[model samples]
Target: MRLIIGGGTLAGKPQLLFIHGIGSARTSDVELREWSTSLANGARAAGHADLVSGLTQSWAAETRFANYSDLFYRADAQGAADGISEEELPLLLALLEEMTQELGHQAELAGDRRSGDIIDSARAQIRAAVEPDAVQGQGLFAVVRRAGNAVTTLLQLPGLRQASQWTSGVQLLPVLSQVGRYLARKEPDDAGQGLDVRIRERVLSGLDPSRPLIVISHSLGTVVAYEALHMYTGRVPLWITLGSPLAMGALVLQRLAPRPPQTPAGVERWLNFWDRDDIVVARPRLERWMEANALGVVPVTARADTHGLWTHTATKYLAHKDVAGPVAETLKNL
Candidate 1:
């Protein structure tokens, strides 16, 4: 897959890097180019013609994509064609346990023992939820995906919706538990030993430290991007994260490399976008968590697909003026 997104050449011009999230290992280069073009189109349509020019102008064609999904696939030796590898099964289970324990602790602090009990009960049902399908020869990933989907569906039920005031992260934890596991997995020092390290390497491969760089990461990619920025020796003037789960205290924040900081080093501005209904990102506004860090948390209205999680789609975020406007403005200023 192509890593760079703008102009065929990469001699000069500021770099705009897009890092994608889960289930995107198979996204092709052609599709990424179209996304870049779509963002430009959306910006122009929203009356940001000047900002769009920064991307399209022949002399300074500047956008790139850091495609690191394959790194995860490779680390697990699970190609996109096949679902997830068997190795991830243990990691998934372990993470599920940890997530439940953490949630229980949070509930205990709030003196909501009932909610804690509910989480424990739900945790016990996870295996039952997947065993039938796994016994039928469905891949583990498929099983987990189905289980996650089921949680999303159940959350929307009228009765369930009114049961308790579950925060977004806790409510979505069942669906996102695996993601939390991958991010928290102990990483080896060697870049090749872990998916996170490999992803960072890919993002830094073509990074010209001298030029202006803006990073746009969505979903799990935001975690990878955050760690990469911490390690990279360069200047990233702006970091735009969409549908990010970074603010999910114990589940994500504590697991990050270098830990979650007030702001990543070298970042002058951090803008985060989230659709209030997007479950993956339990916390919509990051500035609250990353307090006084010059972070801007902007809200967007995204349709909750029947499937629910698809609301985090990058295409949808890119199509919005809220997202496009800042992108154009960032490029124009650069």
Candidate 2:
């Protein structure tokens, strides 16, 4: 796929690469426009009116989107449900359980008894569906279906309806299946390249060595961007990760490509933003586990809150002033 949105001329401007998380199936142009609009709104809120105009008008930076979500699907598959594999089932189940438990804890801390009860019920259902004796006769698909139905039931609750709005009718299982698949690092194509390798290649292909580059990645995309950055030789002025799962110890961190995860050598500065309400974010601070590169570059993390129910969307994170201010300032300098 073409990296440049709208195939516009760069005119020797700095490049801004956006790496999206899972469940993004739209075309590159649509994704680019939506992301640019959200980023522009955030810049405007941060009082960077000039930067806002540049972003909206497509003049300040050569914006590109690394679109790899489509790669998860096959030519004949209907959707993500068809992409799920038996090997990824265990990881998916583990994440679902972890998220349910965390949400239950949060609900309890807030003294929301009803929500807590609902989350607890969901957790129990997931566990029951995945138990060894239960799945032995039912098969992996049975576990997937039962666990997904549990999430659907939880989302359908009046208390969680708002939070589930982003997903609409989509099942949480399929949305999360993308994450499990990526972390599993299994080969999806006949070429023998692992899924993670293909995704990193897609991200790296978007980088232009001749221009000053800034990378903004969210959720699973953050994982892809991090690994790709290590393979890159060009300098990156700024790298931003939003709602990342990088700090998720067993489910993610330990399974990462590079050993003893550290800041990419080419990154001059890294900023990580997360929302407390975002279930996808296991830990908000990445600097705690990551080491500084030779250039002394390490992720400076901060909390950026979002209103209503769900806060994990890339646009929601980008719209926050805390996340956008640095981006605008960096663009202004670039």
Candidate 3:
């Protein structure tokens, strides 16, 4: 069984597990469960008074999708609802239904499945990505809007563009280190084996060893995944990122792990995927990931649908059309 949102897919039978990284306050695992199934949001603060019809989208931008039409339709908050607000959920679901029908038709023409398959796909992935008790692992999209904080630095904002991080949210380095270890196990060798030992001690202790693992990260989550792989000397399968912050300090984890060509054994294999013109993870990505290629790092680029829009509502089409291909193929092979 599989969940096939526009470009993303998640296994259903013997559900595949996913875990979302930390985000805003007032979020919890309970909320995430509900949101994942519904594909809703809690954004009461999206625009407030700042939303502009003309500015909602910029045509001149380079993106993965044709436009925001795909975004609005795929707006179901069907993942984690940890940081979303109470008022924003319903609106998100409406968008999901709209997007599914539209994309399903498009996908059919492209030789995928019927329109109904969109909903089925979304349903499967939502359930598999999140644990009934754990909410979810990482996802293909992430939302980052700092009304007046440093989070907006990637783009130009008034006070927000220049301010330093004020929120005590999840830091980047620790998260990346954690994810890298998971992917590192895909390869087999001394470094990979040793890293797996540490990962087992840290995360895999309770995990059912045979259960298939899939990691989908966005923004900072991407950075977390990268650092983890690098720290462990590269080994992961199905690594996906949207609007990643790979250049950031924490995600980079400079020299934390040893140089390449000397990787250890028993590490996991990998497939690193990202978007271009993601605002958060724009250029210079080729160069960075290229360095890891020597240590068995395999990276792929998944173009975005719209410029700088990091949320599911914005990138769902790309997730299914552009991003899900390699992921589904790899999972089948595994």
Candidate 4:
């Protein structure tokens, strides 16, 4: 949103690109501007004063926001303008159902009745979240209410939560379900909603291939960014992901373009930041599942700004030194 282009050239300065994830249709240019400001302020807070002023003077305007939420929202715009659509509910419900079913099946297979009960409880909560009267379409308040209801329901499922931590593959079910829904959602052909192609195209269009790239993506945007890297034959010197779910295992990783390599192609370094309390990022140590050395997970303290899963917010993710450190490193390299 803050495009300060065409100034004196800062040769070899990596362009910083921000790609937002889901539930971001309402995000305003002001919020994006604030995020860029925070990154600069964060850099200063992290004792990178030289990097801060160097970036501000040399390439302040080079940062770009690859906003795709409006495009994503348009695809599922059948409900109240401020709330999740009626059509979206079914798709989301299906994901929740599938997750519960998978967990239930796994519990059954393991002869864990306790976990099965928890799965059933989770299923009920998912059902409750989409019920006809589950969420009043009053306004943003209602949307918050609906999300709160769903989150509360899930949080109460101790069995499912316990089993997920104890079981190797179970923790991935919820993460997979969310990723599955994003990948499977149907949009009008002209809407350009598919992640690997359409969304990736939107992300790539804002990129300047010649410049070194430092990609900062949040949530589902990380998925799209990763795909775009595989499709585009350009170099990304730094790939930073905030609250990404890409480490959720086979359901997501195995299906990635370039087929889940040790490190993404064209990416010299990858820094993934995750808050332990952020529900969106199920697994953060991507290197454990993939290759080593290139990818590192930096855990940050989650801020409980509000109830529910807002811990995944970009503002909180961007406020940390762990995140700013990598950006400083990229700028220092330049």
Candidate 5:
């Protein structure tokens, strides 16, 4: 991991920090390259040649990634034979239940009755798959396996699969497991510090109160960034969250660190982006749920559609002009 002792800024340039979501076990340098490339591509798509040039050049020197996924790594590789741990099971179930409900609601909004039926059927299948008596003869592992298969089956459904672009239950399970481990706040590293605390510390370390900072976070990282900003004394000119689950009431919203959720005092403006087909997103509009902070900073939520099958990917969201345009504009003004 690259340490930013004096803050992320280089010379007088502003700092841009990227906080990634779940399943990012790769090195920070590798992720920085990938994320920077995506952001540059996005700026190009937004017709900001200057921003693209800057990102491709010295802007990288000023950028930092809050890499915390290393803390969640296990001796057994992800998606291994061990399956989801008992501690992570409840969180996964809660997330899946909430996802199904949101999917049904989205289908209704789109007037897609067939999709709604498919979601309802999948919900029933999941409920039955996890029932104690359903797998009485089998062990707990059997129950988890069946539940995972059911969720995968739902994703593979003809319509839903095409819409979501995510077909592997194997891939989804690990992502949910990591997210669960963080939100459950029960797991600790070898040092005895809570995983949540450690993860937030990683984020806080990248924050430099001395510079004009812009934070761009995705998925579960949004949760970490949100909490870290609350604890930070610096001010952020812009904050962006993509495909976040913060609106997943029971599983995420209620479990946030601060008592009642509000825009972090340090943030001046917040932009939240979501795709209707992104299964990770429960509700697209965060402004409706999170209260404005003392700075009167409330999230301005917008839809940035990525028609790809898997709209949840950070790169996919970054590539959208609607999403990238704002970042470029903010940077230009800064």
Candidate 6:
């Protein structure tokens, strides 16, 4: 019941729930969740249009983004940490489905189908894999998380990924999925609606009345996470935002601080993480709410992403040192 909603990899899992960031050419998280996870020679690419940047076709993009996972090798540390859980399973499956479909376009190159037919054939296979009572506990289910996504969800497909790079918009489609594309289409406020309700149902309802809850979020996802707190329940143990743009906007800060969540225990704890140069975090002049809530805070700046590091590794890695590690250590001392 604990909730972690933020840009894909920033959500860190085991119990971490990924909320992919903005992108174009959207697909459904439910549908994009099913790509071949064991990895293959010609595994497709990932990301929404924005994530892909300048790619034009799925084939070129797939070849460019060819990571080792596509070849089904051993996993990195974080990816092997945990299974994709029931809640996140659907979204991952949908992304995989979308990627596989994109890869299906290759069938046309191989002469298995026609141009338009490629999209159709891939979609059909994706649909078949997702059908209820399909191959349960196999294929995608074989691995907790496809090595790529697990890495991206927490790492945002860091630069280290080798083999092939995401070559085009079409290739990024699989990773970004329809959900990301859909978010791209919606106004920030509009997208916040569904997330708000989900927060109440998943986050607010799931926490113990007596114990405080930890809410970890990042980037644009931080906006809704705070919105949910302001509009929904008032009980939280800690609210951590990594690569958060909210810290730079005082209006946003003041709005969130007024009536924090109400846990049975006492007041809440909010640990805000920021990368100073990050455009998302903005400047010191923008922070408005700190003076309002004014709790005992530990403010420290780590490395800067300089014009927004699309990847959020700094936030996660530091939080391990400053956020989670501290929290666990503090809990231990208590």
**Native-to-model Cα distance after best TM-score fit, residue 92 in candidate 6, in Å:** 25
- lDDT string, candidate 3, 72-159, tens digits: 1223435423333223322222222333333344445556554235335553433332333322233222221111111122222221
Per-residue lDDT over 1-334 for candidate 5, one digit per residue giving the tens place of the 0 to 100 score? 1223344535446678889997647698888777878888888888986677577553533778789988887675454434576557767777888888888898899998877887888788678755756445665577677667767766754434864434567557767777778887866768888889998998878556877788899999899888888898876888999999998887899888796889998899899998887777787788888988998989999888877776777888888887778778877776
Q: What lDDT tens digits, residue by residue, belong to model 6 across residues 217-327?
A: 555455555554554443444555666544432233433433441211322565555542221244322234443233443333343232323433323323233444433
Count of clashes, each model = 1, 0, 58, 0, 2, 40
Clashing residue pairs, backbone N/CA/C < 3 A, model 4: none
Cα TM-score of candidate 2 = 0.88
The estimated TM-scores of all candidates read 0.66, 0.88, 0.38, 0.66, 0.89, 0.36
Give per-residue CA lDDT, model 4, range 171-195, as digits (tens): 2333323355456545535555453
Top-scoring candidate (TM-score) = 5
lDDT of each: 0.59, 0.79, 0.32, 0.59, 0.78, 0.35
**Model 6: residues with Cα > 4 Å off, grouped in runs:** 1-195, 231-237, 247-268, 276-280, 284-289, 294-310, 313-315, 318-320
Indicate the residue-level lDDT of 61 in model 2: 81
Worst 10 residues of 2 by lDDT: 76-85
lDDT tens per residue, model 1, 1-334: 1123444656446777888876534554754676676677768866887555455442333557777665543344433213333444444444444444554564576677666566656566555644644725876556555445445443543224443434332334333434643574544545436656556788788788877787878888888887888777667767778878776666676777674455766787777777543435555556666633344322232322222334556766777776777667766666
- Cα-lDDT of candidate 2: 0.79
When summed lDDT is taken over every stretch of 10 residues in candidate 1, the lowest stretch is: 297-306
Residue ranges of candidate 1 with Cα displaced over 4 Å:
1-12, 50-61, 74-149, 152-178, 185-192, 291-309
> Residue 42 of model 4: what lDDT?
64
Return the top candidate by lDDT: 2
Give lDDT: candidate 1, residue 198: 59
